[model samples]
Target: MMNFSLPMIFSFFMVLCGLWSFVKYHKHLLNSLLSLEFMMLGVFWLMGLQLTSVGMEIYFSLFFLTLAACEGALGLSLLIYVVRSHGNDYFSSFNLLSC
Candidate 1:
């Protein structure tokens, strides 16, 4: 069946990684952020697999990859700032909204 294809396998792996990241996030900010990225990658791959046209699918995949890169860059920059301010990246220490 089509469900047993490579794309499905990869997508399943992505979900598993995302779940692991979410679980790890409670203990570390970096882990959570990376987990979010893992989930995004799954979405990107699925989007590419949904289309039938090879040319169009490639374009969509490229677009998704670009978005993913942007996300990683922004997340990394934010992480850098947070680490500089707190000397570490931990979810429990984040209380900017508690004022």
Candidate 2:
């Protein structure tokens, strides 16, 4: 039990670090998107560990991975669109009220 708990604790800290990075460097679109991906990966790792320890089917992890991939693709597309439209990925140039 001690061994299992140690890894679980480590994974939790991994997720927290991802969250911290996301909050710390959220001014740029690309940085925030990368941080989000990092968080997703950490969560995926945690889910896999928990599921395996519980002896549950691992299919859910695959599904979660698929969603993460889709999310990453979408974020990249958005980043591209923003860069093309605004000439950069900085949030200050977004101009949310401009329509």
Candidate 3:
């Protein structure tokens, strides 16, 4: 009998989504951001599922969520600038904007 724990499943989602974010990150900006958010959410979910101490998890999740929101905001702003300046959303094109 192969029984999968909830935390284990969530952890797999975290790793898989994290890998996906890194693999395609240099190709498309929007897709990469979405995948990164997915990975972050997976981390939040796993923390909720696997924590032994409710108090610790609550504080950790609060801090993590705050950081995630800041990251998402910065990513979205860069995405907007990339799209407006390049007239496209590819990561390579955005890199050209810096030079």
Candidate 4:
């Protein structure tokens, strides 16, 4: 029988929390961004685990994390723009031609 370590357990838990966050709050754009952050954290944890398990560096994972951060920043910026123009962050309020 293979034994699971603490890191593996923690990684799994992080993934579960991330999935839960995404599922529990799907309607709000801010919440969706927060949930995506949580999911990226899970990816970070999994990358760490893979690094330790395989004795290899995770340069690509770090790059992926950076990309995720950029994506989140852009998303939030768009959300802010929408809110400033429409007075609300609801998904249904976006109309490109009306601007």
Candidate 5:
């Protein structure tokens, strides 16, 4: 069994909080996006700690960070488009068929 360290514990807590926030505020796109960003941060921190603990290279974490950046850019662009079209940022207002 792998031993948990302080960074790992902190990361886990952050991820749990983020997930809870996401579930509790799913109807609010901004809130959900913020929660998702927190979750991604937790993942990055945990992965970095794991890599350092095992004496492995950090390339994978770097790649994941890049991918996360791209995802954020795309997500925000989509959100902007939705807000512009509907004049509101609620997830319930989105309808693919209507677009």
Candidate 6:
């Protein structure tokens, strides 16, 4: 039986906090992006701990981190584009249905 250590519990709460923050403050694009990153990091932490406990390789965690970085970059680019064109990053101000 695997023991649930303090670090693992902390990581689990971290992920929960991230999700809560994402849902509570999703109006601004920047807040949403930051919350997403927070969730990714928390997941990474949990993955690393679980893999280490199971004596499994950590290559998957590295791949996940790489993908997270790519996602962050893409999100930032989108934010920049929105801010440049609309002068703000609020979803309510940016109309997606317009041509």
Clashes of each: 0, 0, 0, 0, 0, 0
Q: What is the TM-score of each candidate against the true structure?
A: 0.75, 0.91, 0.75, 0.79, 0.93, 0.95
lDDT of each: 0.80, 0.90, 0.77, 0.81, 0.91, 0.94
| Model 6 regions lying over 4 Å from their true place | none
Ranking under TM-score, best-scoring first? 6, 5, 2, 4, 3, 1
Please give the lDDT score at residue 38 for candidate 2.
Answer: 87
- The Cα error of candidate 2 at residue 61, in Å, is 0.8
Q: Tens-digit lDDT track for model 3 on 1-99?
A: 756686768687786978777686758888888888888888877776655434553777778889999999999999998788889887655564465
Candidate 5, superposed: residue stretches over 4 Å from native: none
Q: What's the distance in Å from true for residue 14, model 5?
A: 0.8
Ranking by lDDT: 6, 5, 2, 4, 1, 3
Q: What is the lDDT of residue 35 in candidate 5?
A: 90
Model 1 whole-model lDDT (C-alpha atoms): 0.80
Candidate 6 structure quality by residue, lDDT tens digits, 1-99: 978999999999999999999999989999999999999999999999999989999999999999999999999999999999999988889777873
| TM-score between candidate 4 and the true structure | 0.79
Top TM-score model: 6
lDDT of 4 by residue, 1-99 (tens): 756888878877887887898788776678877878887888787787777688887887888889988988898998898788988876667777898
1-99 per-residue lDDT for model 1 (tens digits)? 454678767887897889886886668778877898889889777777766423453776788789899989999999998898887998678787853
Better lDDT candidate (3, 4): 4
Top candidate (lDDT) = 6
Query: Every model's Cα RMSD, please?
Result: 2.8, 1.8, 3.6, 2.3, 1.0, 1.0
